[model samples]
Target: MKISLKTIIAGGALAAIAALAIAAPAADNWENHCAKCHGADGKGQTKAGKKLNVKDYTDAKVQSEFSDADIVKATTSGISDKAGKEKMKAYKDELSEAEIKEMAGYIRKFKK
Candidate 1:
């Protein structure tokens, strides 16, 4: 079988587009996965957020309390209350490590 240069280039472009689609942007992930509780502005002001008593990512003090690793761990493993009640659902199965790291960095940008 012979593949033309144009064909190969087109195939490569399609592959790249597929990869991009598979790996959603951090903001999109945050909006889809976190905005319900964290709010789109990271202020934790949504109704669900208020009910859950979620922290405000826009607060520098709140941001200072956690490290990037902490964010990764929370996102990958999820958070729970002291009684072992689940708070956040784990995303390790849904998100790649790279995506999780990207999310952590994205969260950092919310600090005021």
Candidate 2:
């Protein structure tokens, strides 16, 4: 069957919109649900993050201390547990493994 120009254009447009729609919501979710505590820039600005002196992902020394695995675990379980405390809320139930990774990668940006 031949693909019509109209069909091709519509399909391409749909794909483009779909891609943006999907990617945007995830980033927004990460920002709204997690950013406040983690800092919009991902430096751990949550009230607890501040009181407990949360790890600064932007710090070269701090970022270097943990591997990618460590970041994902930290996001999923909570920063306090990884660091040995109760300063953070465990997100194991709240967020998926992929989301946790996204948050980690978001924070990793600060390392530079």
Report per-prediction Cα RMSD to one decimal.
1.8, 4.7
- The TM-scores of all predictions, comma-separated, are 0.86, 0.62
Number of the top lDDT candidate? 1
Q: Model 2 Cα displacement at 31 (Å)? A: 2.0
49-101 per-residue lDDT for model 1 (tens digits): 99999999999999999999999999999999999999998999989999999
> By how many angstroms RMSD does model 2 differ from the true structure?
4.7
lDDT for position 51 in model 2: 72
Off by over 4 Å in 2: 1-26, 45-48, 79-85
Full-model lDDT for every candidate: 0.95, 0.73
Screening candidate 1 with a backbone cut-off below 3 angstroms (N, C-alpha, C), the clashing residue pairs are none
Expressed as tens digits, the lDDT of each residue in 1-112 for candidate 2 is 7999999999999999997665445468667676666676768877856876667777899988989888777667765545576766777776767677777676677786
